[model samples]
Target: MTVRPITITGEPVLHRPTRPVTSFDEELRQLVADMFETMDLANGVGLAATQVGVDLRLFTYAFANDDDAPDRGVVINPRLVLGKISEEDPDRDEEAEGCLSVPGLSFPLKRAEQATVSYQDEDGVQRRFEAHGWFARVMQHETDHLDGKLYVDRLNKRWSAKARKAIKREGWGVPGNTWLPGRDEDPFGH
Candidate 1:
């Protein structure tokens, strides 16, 4: 397993929609293994194929906890089955978010309250999981990467302005439309 370099915002590959994996054979399996190593090396909870220069619908993540236990996983050819928002969702936390691709930039953004997602494991097995709170947020963040979407694009105006300023001052590559302005709606099929 090797740690792959993450592609930043300016990379054209990051903007391309990922292709679905047609086979879960040895090569794909090895990529997943390497992805786990890379995610750990970068101190990230999740890493998507696109971020690592592979245009496939694959991602790996471990849930963050105080114990810092390893919960490494691979989601191959994952697809969204269901998603929704909650009434209890706190409106737009100013918590900073970082990306493996967009290194040196940690910006605050708004995300979903909860999410129920289904995806296939590396072994060709199917699984559906419900994630709320932080876990839900992680799921959404990773899912966005798969769809060629970044968290910075989802921020409200005020937060986005601050993030934009930071990127500019640092001479960082802040992709245009980094945050899609407006109220976010569910991106899942009913």
Candidate 2:
């Protein structure tokens, strides 16, 4: 599978909702494989189709929990069901989050503690699963990408202002600000 170039913040594809996956053919399988490869190369736990310039409602995730139990899969045309947070425990926790589209930047953002997603597999089979803690956060983050939203959109006002300034300074707010893995220069500056 080839690692596709990741689109940056200013790309229109990343800002608009993606279309549902209608065909579960070899082309779709290759796209999913390529997404996994691209996500791995970028060192991202989760990636959406829009991040790779494919306007389809699909995402791939590779995550390991505290015990090192690996969780990897693809979600196509997902529907999320968030669990209610306790009154004493706020839904918004200060946790660090980053996006492949907006490289070299990370900030603490609030996310749900639990989520249950219903989605189809690569073979068009229905599946449902629950995620908690970091897994839940990752699911939320990736799902947002399918909806044409980013982690920055959920940032608090203070962090949002800081992120905007950094985007401007780094010249990342324009389309075509992309880097291919293992070929182009490191955009994160190592």
**All candidates: TM-score:** 0.77, 0.90
Give per-candidate clash totals: 4, 0
Residues 138-182 of candidate 2 have per-residue lDDT tens digits of 989999999999888777777889889988988887888787877
Model 2 weakest lDDT span, ten residues long? 85-94
Q: Candidate 1: lDDT over CA atoms?
A: 0.68
* lDDT (Cα, tens digit) per residue for candidate 1, span 35-146: 8876766667898888877889889998953322235577766665445544342244445677766555666655565666678887788877666666667777888888
- Candidate 1 stretches greater than 4 Å from native: 64-70, 81-94, 169-190
Output the TM-score of candidate 1.
0.77
Question: Which residue pairs overlap in candidate 2's backbone?
Answer: none
TM-score of candidate 2 relative to the true fold: 0.90
Give the best candidate by lDDT.
Answer: 2
